[model samples]
Target: MKVMTVFGTRPEAIKMAPVVKALEASPHIQAQTVVTGQHREMLDQVLTLFEIQPDHDLNIMKEGQTLSDITRSALQGLESALERFQPDLVLAQGDTTTAFVAGLAAFYAKIPVGHVEAGLRTNNIYEPFPEEMNRRMLSTLTNLHFPPTAESRENLLREGHRSEDIFITGNTVCDALQTMVANLPPGRPPELSHLPPNCRILLVETHRRENLGEPMQEICRALRRLVKDFTSVEIVFSVHKNPRVREVVFPALEGHERVTLLEPVDYPVLIRLMRE
Candidate 1:
């Protein structure tokens, strides 16, 4: 069996790495990888850490690309790659535009699509903006749904997906987390070494589209309050690269001594930070 896996973002790379490894190890499966490059540097960081080199890279990232740009680029790039590779099945993970478009392209080509972490629904599709809708649409295009929980499997069944096509597989993020934690080096990360030994660390990651303006300001204000009220509590915020998120976050929290705003770390570093 030939399997081609497509992914682009940091989260998708982390989640799909284990599946790609498993496919490569299988005696009957030939595994191939394609990267859409929706998140260039961040995506590459995860791929490097996992030692995954893609067979094809679409290199679709641009300075101010819109959602439509990403979807259109991925669809075109993947269609050509799929035509060349012609795998028995195409696989995509999570709810990024890359994943959704990859599945859509495969469906158009009459190739079966296997979706990992499928059947996740907020019902309010607009709540998570495109992510919720992306997953829902992929659920319709997918031939095999690898849901992370029984609840997710039930969600698929409730949506009228055949039980035979749905499989309850555990989340790949947890699998990646466990592997990274086990291999983590001793002691605190060098970046956090400036703080006192007894100081407690609070890691924060906020980049939801819904939290863009006023909500983001409120979150920053809350963090500022927390640092002010507690001397021993230090915050390590891995800020998103989006200018909109940075605009509100930096001004609200930057000058504070206890709050350290940083560029996003790679997957293993993130896992190590969480473990510590």
Candidate 2:
């Protein structure tokens, strides 16, 4: 059986890498990979770390792109691929625009779609913006639901999803973490250039766009206070690319000696930073 796995974005790649590997290992299944290139640079970074080269890359990245651009591009691009490849089933994972659009393409082609990491619900449709709605809609079109946990399967059950179609696969995130960490080389991330003898390193990331403006300022203030009170500890924060976050974060922790605010590190560097 031929199975085409579609994913974009770093998190989706990380989670789906193991699934792709498993599918490749199965003698009965032939696996194909596609990357929507929604987050081109970041997606490639994770793919390289996982050593996954896509069979198709929909390189649809654009400056000032909107959600519609992604959906439309993935739909148009993946639709043609679906027609050409004609896989037995299309597999998509996570709550990303790429995942939903790929699954939608499969549905439109009258092809079965297997949704990995299915049935995760915050229940507040708009909390994760369109992602929550995308997942819900994909569930409707999918032939198989691979729930990561019992809680996720329960959520699907509550939403009237068929029990026979749901499979409890546990979370694939742990697999990625283990693989990356075990393979990560020494002395990465310039922020971790200096380690105090045998001292432990702690990594913190706080640049969620949702937490900008007042929330960001508040977090900065709290971090500053913690740095002031704690003399022995060192805090390294990977700053976001957004100018809004930079404006608030810089001013809030300007004079702090212990806190280091650095530019965003790549995935491998991030993994090393986290491990240190």
Candidate 3:
């Protein structure tokens, strides 16, 4: 069976890498990758770390791109690729614009779509912005729903998805994380060299669209309080690339000696940093 796996963000790449590897290992399956390039450099970093070179790269990223731009570009790019590849089934993981549009394109082409990490819901569509809606929509079009947890499967069932179509596969992120951790070279990442000996590490990662403005500022303020109260703790935050996130984050968190606000690290580095 020929399967086209489409993904484009760091989170999606991390989760989908293990699934792609599993597919490649299967004697009966031919696995192919298509990257929408929705996240550009960060996406490429994960791909390189996982050694997943896409058969088709739709370089769709643009500065100041809107949701409509992403959806339109991904739909157009994926449609052409779907026509050319014509896989037996198309697979998309998580709830990015890439996943939603790729699945939609496959539906339009009368091809089956397999959704990985499916059935996640906040019940509030606007809470996570488009992600909650994206996954919910994809669920309607998906032939196979791979939900990573029992709760996720239940969510799909409650939504009237057929039980036979739902498969309770464990999260692939854990698989990826374990694989990387096992292969990690001895010693700490160079970035953490400045960390005081025996200090507790507090890794902070926040880039939710719902928390972008005031909520994000409040989080930064909370982090400030944490640093001030906990002298022995060091905070290493891998800042998001979005300027809006940075605008409030920098003002609240920057210039603090205990808070290390650095550029987002690659997947392995992130894992390593978290380990440290």
Each model's lDDT comes to: 0.92, 0.85, 0.91
Question: What TM-score fits each model?
Answer: 0.98, 0.91, 0.97
Query: Which pairs of residues clash in candidate 1, taking residues 3 or more apart in a chain or in different chains?
Result: none
Cα error of candidate 2 at position 5, Å: 0.8
lDDT of 1 at 8: 94
lDDT of 2 at 171: 84
Single out the weakest 10-residue window by summed lDDT for candidate 1.
267-276
Model 1 alpha-carbon miss at residue 89, Å:
0.8
Model 1 per-residue lDDT at 239: 95
Q: For candidate 1, lDDT tens digit of each residue in 53-122?
A: 8999999999899999999999999999999999999999999999999999999999999999999888
Question: Better model by TM-score, 2 or 3?
Answer: 3
Candidate 2 has which clashing residue pairs, if any? none
Candidate 3 on 1-276: residue-level lDDT in tens?
Answer: 889999988899999999888898899998889999999999998888888889999999999999999999999999999899889999999999899998999999999999999989999988688998999899999999999999999999999999999999988999999999999987889989988889999999899888899999899988889889989989999899899899988888888979998898888888889888
lDDT of 2 by residue, 1-276 (tens): 999999988789989999888888899998899899998887888888778989999999888888999999999999988998999999999888899999899999999999999999999888677789989999998899999999999999998989999999888898888887887777755676664555534466775546879989888877877767776667778887667888987787765777777787787678778776
Off by over 4 Å in 3: none
